[model samples]
Target: MRAWSGQWRPGEGFGEPLPAWDGPSTLVLVFASPAVIADDTPPDPGGPLAGLLEAYPASVVMGCSTAGEILGGTIDDATVSVAVAQFASTRLRLLTGPIGGGTDSAAVGRDLAARLVAAEPDLAGVFVLSDGLRANGAQLAQGLSDGCAGTAVITGGLAGDGDRFDHTWVLVDGRPRTGMVSVLGLSGPHVRVGHGAGGGWSILGPERLVTRAEGNVVHELDGQPALTLYRSYLGDRMGDTAASTLMFPLSVRAPEGRQGAVVRTVQALDESAQSLVFTGDVPQGSIARLLRANTGELVDGAGEAVRRADLVPGLPTLALVVSCVGRRAVLGQRTEDELEMVMSRLPADVHLAGFYSYGEISPIGEHTSGLLNQTLTVTTIQETAA
Candidate 1:
C-alpha cells in the first residue's frame, strides 16, 4: 500500500500537490475543522474538499468534521487533513444512511452492516463515521457489532464540532452532510487491520449507582439528580457543563453479561430535567465513577494504545487515531504530545491521519464493540503481499 498525507488551510491550499501515484487510490480519508465545514456562505462553501475530490475522484472518500485535525505527527485546529491510500490487494466499499435522530442510531448501524456484509461477503473490517450529536454512539456500536457477528472488525468515531457539541458533519462521497452515517468496508486476504483503545483516567470519589437512566441520558445517580451530583464534582467549574465536563468524564460499568466498563463523556446537560446526556450509554443499575487524568497519564495512554494495536513492524501502515475532544480540551497546548507519542510508537513508514472526535468507537473485548469517550482509539491498516 502507498499512502500520502498533507494539510490544507483556508487561504493556503494544500501545502503542496498530492504526490503522483502509479495506480488509482483505494481510499481517501478527509478530516476537516468544523470551521471549514460550517462555512456555507457563498462561492466555494465546499471548502478544501473540492480540491480533494478532484485529486482522488475515483477513490472511496469518507471522513468527518473534527475538534482538531491530525496529519502525520502534527495536530492543528481549523484546518483540513487528508490521507490518500492506494492498496495493492485490498477491495473497498462505502455504505451510507440517514440517522433521523438519536433513537434511530442502532437501526441505522444494523442496516449499514447488513448492506456491507451482503456486498462483501468476505468483509475484513469496517470503519464508521456517524453524526456525533444526533446519534446514540453506544447503540450504534452495539448494532454494528451484533450485525457483523464477529465477521469483521469494527472501528471509527463520531463527527465532532470542536467543543461546541452543537453541530457535526460526516463526509460521504466527498460531500459533507449532517444526520448521516458512513461506513467504509475493507476486504481481501492481504488487507490487515488491527485496533486498540486506551484511557489513562483515574476514578475519583466513590462509585455511585445509576438510579434512573434512559439510553444515554442519566436522570439520577444513587437517587440524586444526575446533573446535581456531577456538579458537586465540578464545583466552581460547573458553569460550562459541556466544556468543563470533558476534564472529568464518567467510568460506567455496564450490567452483567455485557461489555465491561467503558468511559462516557458528557455531550449535553438538561438543566430543567437535572439530567446529563453522555456520548455513550450509562445504563440504569450500572455503576458510575467520575474520572480524572494528568498529562503524563494521558500521553502514556496514547502509547499504550499503540502497543495494544500491535501493528507489524517494518510494514507500510496507516494509523487512524480517533481521540476524544475532551482529551484535546484537557491537553490544551500539550495536545500534540499524544499525537507525537502515537507516531513514535508506530512503525517508521506509518502514515498517521485522524481527528479528535465527540465519541470514539472501538472494540472493548474480543468482538464486543463499544462507544468510548475521553479515550484514545487507534485503528491500523496494512496490505501484505497477495
Candidate 2:
C-alpha cells in the first residue's frame, strides 16, 4: 500500500500542488473547514478538488469539515488536509448514506455494517464519519457492533463544525452535503488495523449522580437542573457558554458496569429546558463529575494513546488521528503539543492525516468502540500478504 498527504489553503488556489503518485488511489480522505465546501457554496465537481477526484475517479472519497486540520505535527486552522491511499493487497468497499435528524442511529450503523459484512465477511476494519451534531455517537457504535456481530473492528469519529456547533458537512464521493454519513470498509486477508484512545482530563471534586437525562441531554444532576449545577461551578465564566464551559467537561461512567469513564463536553445550554447538551449520551443514574485538563498530562495522554495502539511493525500505510475539539480549546495555540506527541511515536514513513473532531470514536479496554469527547483516538493501518 502507498499513501500521499498534502494541505490546501484558501488563497493558495487549486493551481497549487497536490499529492502526486504513479498508481491509482483506492481511497481519498479530506478534512477541511466548512467555508471551503458546504451546501451553500457547493464545490464545483470540477473545482479545487477536481485534480484529486480526477486523479482517482474510482476512489471512494469520504471526509468532513473539521474544527481544525491535523497536518502532521501541526494543528492548522482554515486549511484542507488531504490523504490518498493506494492499496495493492487490500480491497475497500465504500458505503455512503443519509442520516435523518430523528433516524435511529443504531439502525443506520447496523445497516451500514451489515451491508459491508454481507459483501465481505472477512472485513478487517471499518472507519466511519457521520454528522456529529444530528447523530447519536453511542447508538451508532452500538449498532455497528451489533451488525458486525464481533466480526470486524470499527473505528472513526463524528464530523466537527468548528466551535459554531451549527451546520456540519460530510463529503461522499466528490459531493459535500449535510445530514449524511459515510463509511469506508477495508477487507480482504491483507489489511491489518490497530487503534487506541485516551483522555488526559482529571476528575474534579466527587462523582455525582445523573438524576435525570434524555439521550444526550442532561436534565438534572444530583436531583437539580444540570445547567444550574454546572453554573455553580463556572461562576464568573458562566456568561460565555461556548468557550468557558469547554474547559470543564463532564466525566461520565455507567453506574453498574466496569467500563471506563468517558468525558463529555457541554455542546449547548437549553435555557427553556434548563439542561445541558453533550456530544453523546449521558445515561440517567450514571456517575458524573467535572474534569479539568492538566496541559502536560494531556500531552502525555496523547503519547499514551499512540503507545497503546502498538501499530503494525515496520511502518503504517496510513495513520489517522481523531482528537477532540475540547483538547484544542484547553491547549489553545499550544494544541500542537498533543499532535506532536502523537506524531513523535509513529514511524516517520507513515502517512499522517487527522482532524480535531466534535467527538472521537474508539473502544476503551474491553468495551466496544463508542462516541467520546475530549479524547485522542488514533487509527493505524497496514497490509501484509496472506
Candidate 2, residue 248: CA error in Å?
1.5
Each candidate structure's TM-score, on Cα atoms with residue i matched to residue i, is 0.92, 0.91
Candidate 2 per-residue lDDT over residues 151-270, each given as its tens digit: 777889888888887888788767777788888889888888888887887777788999999888999999999888888876886664646687788889888766777888887888
Candidate 1 residue spans exceeding 4 A from truth: 22-25, 39-47, 231-242, 268-273
lDDT of 1 by residue, 72-93 (tens): 7788888989888889878888
lDDT of each: 0.84, 0.81
- State which candidate has the highest lDDT: 1
Off by over 4 Å in 2: 11-25, 40-42, 233-242, 270-274, 365-367
Clashing pairs in 1: none
lDDT computed for candidate 2: 0.81
